[model samples]
Target: MTLEELFAPFGLKAPPLRVLGLTLDSRRVEPGYVFVAVPGVPLPHRKPLDGHDFIPEALAKGAIAVVGERELSLPVPYLRVGDARGALAHLARHFFGEPDRKLALLGITGSKGKSTTASLLHHLLQAGEKPAALLSTVGLRLGKEARPNIGHFTTPEAPEVYGFLREAVERGLEAAVLEVSSHALALKRVEGLSYRIGVFVSFYPDDHLDLHGTAEAYFATKALLVERSHLAVLNTRLPHLKRLLPRPHLLFGPGGEVWGEGLREGEEGLRFTLHTPWGSGEAFLPMLGRYNLDNALAASAAALAYGLSLEKVLQGLATFRGVPGRMEVVQKKPFRVVIDFAHTGKSLEEALKTLRATTRGRLLLVVGAAGERDPRRREDIGRVAARLADKTFFTEEDHRTEDLQAILEALAKAAGEEGGLYEIIPDRKEAIFRALSEAREGDTVLLAGKGHERTLERGTLALPWDEKAVALEGLTALGLGGGEHP
Candidate 1:
């Protein structure tokens, strides 16, 4: 397509240039490609490599035109935009033919519950005869494609994000439930796409200082989704929900528009009363914790808003198997092994508190910290693990470009200073094995972090690994791998 055709979506006149494809990264530029240069938000005294530096490289690669920030001198056609990221989103939509318009789009945003809620919402919609697609930290699964796209980041780049959505639409998917991250909102990835229903889960302050610089900025990023969504489903349980003042929104919680009351925690999952706009019904989730009740309510609201009846939605909820790694059970051997993706202090506390209620024996928690993002959470996570877990095993969780031992030392110091019971093991697999080896019948071993992750990343190596699979191997060795406790 010509550059004019590509820029049509942005309401800008296309330059006299032919472009074969579009990209923001200069490395991916090729002949007939339009490169978009987006200036990164500088962090305090530090500054990011400006997109202008790559304009020359992109042009050298035969890029016909460049959509970039102001102050650039290039021989090729260039269009200056006040917000380059927003322009990229708009251009990509037009270039991809606005694929999301053809597919049902559900946007979920919050500090937590986005991934799990998106996964569950997709499951429920598909169960109700709505062929659905999902894009989340867990991975993208559309039609028969199940392998996660290559990346450690929760949300991919704008082009990749739109590419995945376009692929889902091409596969004839009727619905796409996406986990909209704060970074994606701040970067304007969802700037142009229209969501049929937007669900605002709950929020907690974590992993934002580096990008957003402050808690208020993080909160504002989340609010953008609520403001733009056609039907906003807010979690009334959030402590700051009042401050958000979500418009065109229906509140949900333990006693709100969509809720799960009378919750009864169980050994495997929790059974609760699910209340929705249509009617209230008793619902049983094969997943643990009160947080999951909120997740279910959030998904229930989205499904209902998308036109599924309360009966179909509740039926879907009843039959929906939980997402892997989110309160997922790995084994029920001589002991029970539960694998969860709880990395935050609040998440760990909730997981441990929930498990402590059901476990007959010692509650063991194996957790680790992800390097490079939020260093502040290291000690906090360790402290929480020590306070709640009877036995805490600390291991490495994706220490990309960071020293694993150094990271572990930080956590160990925090945990030790707090009088927490914990041990440091740099290898996550070894930590899991050690936790399992220490477990006895009736004991509950909770493997926190790397819940449904299929790969164990270490430096440049990504080895195939699954917590559920490893725990099952141990359970089978113990002769208790057939089924759950009867």
Candidate 2:
């Protein structure tokens, strides 16, 4: 493609020159590349990262032209625009041949359950003999296999997003399921793409408040996906969304278009009778926990809206081994060990409550909150753990460059307020081992946060770590099993 063709659609004039590729990151720039110095607000720093700062790196890396919000004297061609991110999205869409036009997109968004719902929906669609692809917090899946995702962004930047969609089209994928985040929508990472079905999972008032400034703004940004989609699938539990989005949609909770009845949790997982607009049928999930029922119902609703059979959806549910680190069962013998990605207050409470009820003896928890985000979440989770579990281990969880002790103190104070039994362990691996060592027969141990994640951040250093592997290591130390990862 040529520079004229890429920028002309966005009303920017540039010299006609061959453009090999498009990228926002200067490190990825190559010969004849159009580097988008997209100034972004990914963090809450007083001095935000401006793409203009990376111009020299892009030039040194052989970037043919620079597209950014700032105007500066450059060695090569430069185009200044009001919104560099939006322009990057549009130019990528143009260069990628508008791949979304071919692939049917089902966008699942909210603070939580996005990755699970997207995975479930992709599974259901493929069960119906349709080609599907997925982009989620867990990673990218072209088919049944997944590639480990890089970085912490749930939704990656526009260049990668469009490039993936372009690849999905090239692979002849008929559908794509994406886990959209509030930051992605607000920052225009998903710009210029319309969804066939926009799904809204449950929301928490305390999630990502650091970025949205208010719960109202955060909720509004999530609703943006529904604004552009042809159909909106929402949870009836969140009735306020109906008022915010006045458009017609499929509600998936009690008294809604999709509902689950006779829910049962067992050794085999969860089983229930699922009701959808199309029809009702018996459903079985290979994953445990009642909280997953909501994820199942949400995915079923989107699949039904997408014209899949009820039988196919149920089959997909039954065959799904469940997403990694999502209530994953690491060991089940004298004591049970579970690894989950429950970092938020609501998720932590639900997970603890579920395990607490099933525990024949004590319920022990290994949980911590992330850094550089809301502190109120840590307080809420701490209190919840105190009330739900017999004992809690307060430990490290991605305290990136922030005061780790302050974060732990917030949790410890909340636990103390609830009169909860707890211990402060700064080292995450040590905390996990301590929690495991304390578990007795008939007890259940939960390793929460940092689920399925390959890295653990400590003072800006992303140390290589795996929660499941660490849990197994702890189990082996207890003389129960070997350290080999199952």
Candidate 3:
């Protein structure tokens, strides 16, 4: 497509330069590529990263044209728009052939449980004999093939997201489940895509406060997803859910369109009879956290709304193993060592409480808070850790350029308020080793924060980190579990 042809939809006159591809990153700009200069987060000392500054580099790299928020005279065609990110998203949609028009799309959004819910929907689609793709925190799955997504961004930039969707459509996939993040909605990363069903799992006001500036604004941005969706699948119990979405929605909870009865949780997992408008069936979710039962129902409602049978939904639920780092059990023999991606206060509380119920011995916790996001969450996390766990290890978790000692001390103070046994461990690996080494038979060690993340940010360095692998190594090195993985 030529530059003029691409911008014609926006009613803008452009040069007839042929465009081969699109990119937000100037580093990736190549000859014939249309570069969109989107602003990025600021580094420690550097000013807020802006694509405008890199236009020269992009042009030098042989970019045919540049689209940015700032108006500037350049050697190549320069189109200035009010929202460059939105323009990028739209142009990416156009460039990718608007795959959403060809594929049924389901968007799962909220503070937590998005990955599991999206995964469940993908599994249900496959179980119902509909080939689909999934883009979630765990990984990307198209048809029978799957790959781990190692990045921290749950929702990638517009180009990559649309590119993945286009690939899915090309591979003859009929549907896709996308795990939407607040940043994605706020930045117009998913501007042009249409969602057949938007799933609301759970929301934490404190989550992404650093990005949205206020809790009200955070929720308002999140509400945009359901507002754009053809149907919203929401939890009936969350009062805020009904308020945010007024359109046609499927509520999954007591007295809602989809509800569960005869719920049971044990060593195996959860078993509940799911009741929906279309049909009803007994469902068993092979996942921990009874709270996740609602997530399962949310996914079921989305699938049922997407034209899947209740039996297939239940089948997928039964066969679906939980996402990695989400209530993931690392070692199970002597003492249960579980690694989870529970970072927020609500999620951490839920994880700790759930483990407490199953623990015959003391409940051990190794938890930490990230730096530069929300300062209030550190207090919440520390208080929850101390109030619940028998013993808590306050340690480092993505403390990028922040004083690790101060963060640990803040946790100690919060734990002091709870009058619980707690110790500050600066090194994350050491904290895991200590937690595992001290755990006794029947005690469950919950490793909270940094689930499925391949890197740990401390100062400016993002070092390699694998929570489950580190826990297993700690167990083996401690001469506790068998040398081989459990």
Candidate 4:
């Protein structure tokens, strides 16, 4: 498609201009392609060599044209847009042949549970015989085939997001479940894509404080997804959920559209009595926490909204084993070992509380704060571990450029009450082993962060690592628990 044809729908009046492909990254720009200069978060409107300096580099790199906000003194055809990111999303839709036009799309966005909910919805729909695909932090999954999404951006680059959807459509996926993020929504990554249903699992005011500046802005950005959808599945029980989405929506509660009551947590998983509008059933999810119940309910609403049979929905929900890293139980030796991706304060508290509810013995939690994220939540995460966990071990979680020990110290300070139960372990492998070695038969060890991530990144190295594998190895070495794995 030509550049003129791509932006024609967005009211860009231009003479015919040849275009082969589209990309925002200069390194990936090729001949006959338009290079979109996105105003990055850190250096807005500034090119690499210097502000206004890298236009020559981009031009020299075979970029036929450039699309950016600032006026460039380039000889090639350059188009300016009010917001480059928004324009990119719109152009991506056009470039990808508007794949959503032929498929059903569902978007789930929140501070937490987005991954689990999207996965759950995809699994449920697939079990009901609907062709489904899932896009989330975990990766893109089309049926049983999973692919690593190296796109660091949660929403991914707009072009890449649309490209994934195009692939899904080409693969004959009937339904697509996208895990939307606040940054993605704010940047209009999901723009031009129609969603049949939207699910708001729950929201917390941590992570991405740098992007949104304030909680209200963060929430308002996320609400854009719900507003754009045909129907919204919401947890009316949450104050933030109600406040952000004030419109009349499908409520999931006790006896609501999809409700969970009589929730009991145990070593096996969470046993919750589900009461839906269709009928009542009990689900034994191999996941912990009341928050996860909300995830299941949100997923159930998505399934029902897709017009599945009641029996299918219940069966799907009942048979769902668990999502990797979202409160996944790894070792059940003398004690229980859980590996979860609970990095946020709210998630940490919820995981601990769920463990407390079901654990017959003590709770030993190993947690860490991610480097270069919302630093404010670091201390709060520690405090949550301190308050709820019997033993808390703080370590480094993807430090990036930040000091690992500094991160641990901040976590330690926030763990005001957990001083005695806390220890700083810089090495993650040792941290896991130490936790396992200390755990007794009845105790539960919770390994937080890096749940399903197959790689553990330390500095410039990304070594192969899996939490469940490490936990099992530790358990085997300790001669404790045994269970089945796929």
Candidate 5:
């Protein structure tokens, strides 16, 4: 398409320069590409380069057109827009032939359970013989092929989103499930796309305070998805979210359209009777925790909203094992070791509470807070650990450019004098070893933070790290080969 045609969506006139693709990164610019120069926000660990500074580099890379907040005096066609990020979304949508319109898009956004809900919905659609794709905190799946999300972003950049959607359409996929984050909405990363069904799992006042400035602002950003969605699926338990409910919306929770009764938690999984508008049926999910039952209900509600049968939803839920690093049980022997991505205070509390109930003996917890992120929850997490666990080990978790000792000390202080059972270990592997080495028969160790992640961020480097792998190594070093407890 010509540069003029591409900028026409933004109501800007451009020279008749042909373009092959669009990009924000100068390094990705190819011959005949249209580059969008969006300003970057300064982060705690690293400062982003101003896209305006890369104009010359992008031009040298054979970019035929440039989109920016301000016009530039360049030989190539230059188009100025009020918001370059929003313009990028529009241009990408136009370039990709609006793939979102061609595919059924379901967006699940909240402070928690997005990954689980998206994965379950995708599994339901696929099991029903309906073609579907998924994008979540865990990974990206296209049909039968899936890969880990090494990028570590819940919602990818707009270009990648459109690119993936285009590929899904090319492959004849009928639906796409995405886990949308609050940061993505705040940054306008998902500007031009609309969702067929948007689900709100749950909310809490944690994380991303440095960016959003206040809890209200953070929630306002999340509400954007509900505003733009054709059908909104909300958790009625969260009273604040009820204002977002529109006509044709489905509420799920206690006293909602999709509710759970006779909830029973067992060591293996959860067995609950689901009460839905379609009918009431018994459902058993092969996963731990009550929060997971809520996740299952959210996914089932979304599938039903998308026109799937209740039987298919139950079948999919039954066959579905679980998402990795989400209360993932790595061992069930002399002592059970579970790996989970419960970094927030509320999530950590839920995890510890669930384990405390089922654990046969003492419950030990390994926990840490990420550096350069929200520090407000560190104390809350420590407090939760102090109240619930028999022993707590505070260790390193993504201490990017921050002193690991300081982070550990803050948590230690939060545990206070009353909680004397906790110890601070700067090295994560040693902390895991200490926790496992001290464990006896019938004890359970909960490893929080860094679930499916394969790297540990220290300073500016992401060293290779995996919690389950490290735990296995610790077990081997201690001469305790893999075995289950009687």
Candidate 6:
């Protein structure tokens, strides 16, 4: 598309340039590409790398045009906009033929449960025989094909977001489910894309404080999903967010349009009666934790909003196994071992609470926090473990360029002075081994923080790491059954 045609939607005259593609990263610039020089937020221990500094590099790489907030003197065409990120979103939408309009887009945003909810909705739509695609923390899916999303962010850049939807359109997919992050909304990565339905699962003070600066700002960024969506699916349990939904919306949780009752938790899974606007039905989810039930409710509400029946939603929930790394069961023999991505205090508390209820014996926790992100959450994680776990092991989890001992000590300090049984293990693999070795019969071991992630980030290096495999190996070494519990 010509620059004029692309910028027409934004009411700005396009420069005299032909664009073949768009990118934010200068390294990815190619012939006839329009590079956007958007400034990025600086995180802890990292220098702010602005795209404006790389204009020369982009030009050298054959970028035909540049989009930025400031005008630049260059041989190539320059298009100035109030917000470069928003401009990229508009350009991407125009370039991709506005694929979101061709397909039904469902966006799920919150501090947690995004991946599981998005995946569940995708599974439900597919189970109902509707052509659907998924973009989540786990990966991307179109039709029957799924692949891991190697991008560092949950919601990729504007180009990638529209590009994926465009591909979904080509694949003949009728709908798409996306796990929209607060950063994505704040950065305008998902700008110009409208969702058929948006789901707010739950909120908590968690990661990305460095970018957002405050908990309220973080929440406001997430609240954008509700504002831009055609319809909002809200979790009524979080009363603080209720005021954000003054307009018409579908509610979930207690006394909401979709809620769960008659809840029963066991080693096998959970059995609950799912209440929806359409109707109500008993759902036996082969997944652990009440939080998962919340995720199920969110997905069910979204699916029902898309014209799916309650029976189909229940069937999809029943047939669905679970999302990888989110409360995944590794083994069930003398005791139970679960791997979960419970990095936040809220998620950790919920996971431990559920395990404590179901576990007949002691609840053992192996948890840690990522370095160079939010240090405050480190203590919160420790405090949660201190309150719920019979024994806790504070170990290394993605301590990129940060002092390992300092991170462990912070966690140990937050564990409180109640004289709880805890240990500081810097080595993650050894920590898992020690936890498993100390476990007696009927004890439930939870390996939290690193769930389905296959690698461990340590000081700018991504080492091969698998929590489930490591737990299974530890079980096998103890002569316990490595197979999953039936």
TM-score of each: 0.89, 0.94, 0.93, 0.88, 0.92, 0.91
Total residue pair clashes for candidate 2 = 0
Clash count for candidate 6 is 0
Could you tell me which residue pairs clash in candidate 3?
Answer: none
Over 1-486, each residue of candidate 6 has an lDDT whose tens digit, in order, gives 887777677666767567789999998999989899998777766787788999999999998878888767778767788888888898899899989999999999978899999999999999999989999887889977988774657899999999999999999999999999998999899999888899999887656788898888888888889988889999987646666778668999987878999998877778999887698889988888877888888999999889988888889988987888888877776888888899878889888988888788999999999887878888788888888899999999999889889999888888866456799988999999999999988899999998878789889898988787888788888887544564
Clashing pairs in 5: 333-484, 333-485
- Misplaced by over 4 Å in model 1 are 8-20, 26-32, 41-65, 70-80, 143-150, 239-246, 454-465, 469-486
- Could you tally the backbone clashes for each prediction? 2, 0, 0, 3, 2, 0
**Candidate 5 least-lDDT 10 residues:** 477-486
Q: Which candidate, 4 or 5, would have the higher lDDT against the true structure?
A: 5
lDDT of each: 0.80, 0.87, 0.86, 0.78, 0.87, 0.86
RMSD of each: 3.2, 2.1, 2.4, 3.5, 2.6, 2.7
Q: After superposition, how far is residue 296 of candidate 6 from its true place, in Å?
A: 1.9
lDDT of 5 by residue, 1-486 (tens): 788888887777888777789988898999989899999876655576689999999999999988898757888778888888888888888888899999989999988899999999999999988889998888889987897773667888788888889999998999999899998898787888789999988877655778887888888888888888899998987747557864568999987999999889998888999889999789989989988988999999999989888898888889997888899988887788899999978889999998999889999999999988867678887888888889999999998888899889888888875464799998999999999999888889999999988789999898988898898888878777657532
What TM value does model 4 have?
0.88
The lDDT, on a scale of 0 to 1, for candidate 5 is: 0.87
Strongest candidate by TM-score: 2
**Candidate 2 C-alpha error for residue 482, in Å:** 4.7
lDDT string, candidate 3, 1-486, tens digits: 788999898777888888889998887889999999988864332347788889989989999888988868888777789888889999999988888899989999988889888888898898889999999888899988998773678998898899999999999999999999988998888898779898888777777766777788988888888888989888766537658556888888887889999999987789988888987888888888898888888888998899987777777888987788899887776788888999978899999989888899999999888887677788888888888999999899999877889888888888899888999989999999999889888899999998888899988888988888888788879896574333
Error of 5 at 231 (Å): 1.5
What is the alpha-carbon lDDT for the whole of candidate 2? 0.87
Q: After best superposition, candidate 6 residue 330: deviation in angstroms? A: 1.0
Off by over 4 Å in 3: 2-4, 10-20, 30-32, 40-47, 241-246, 480-486
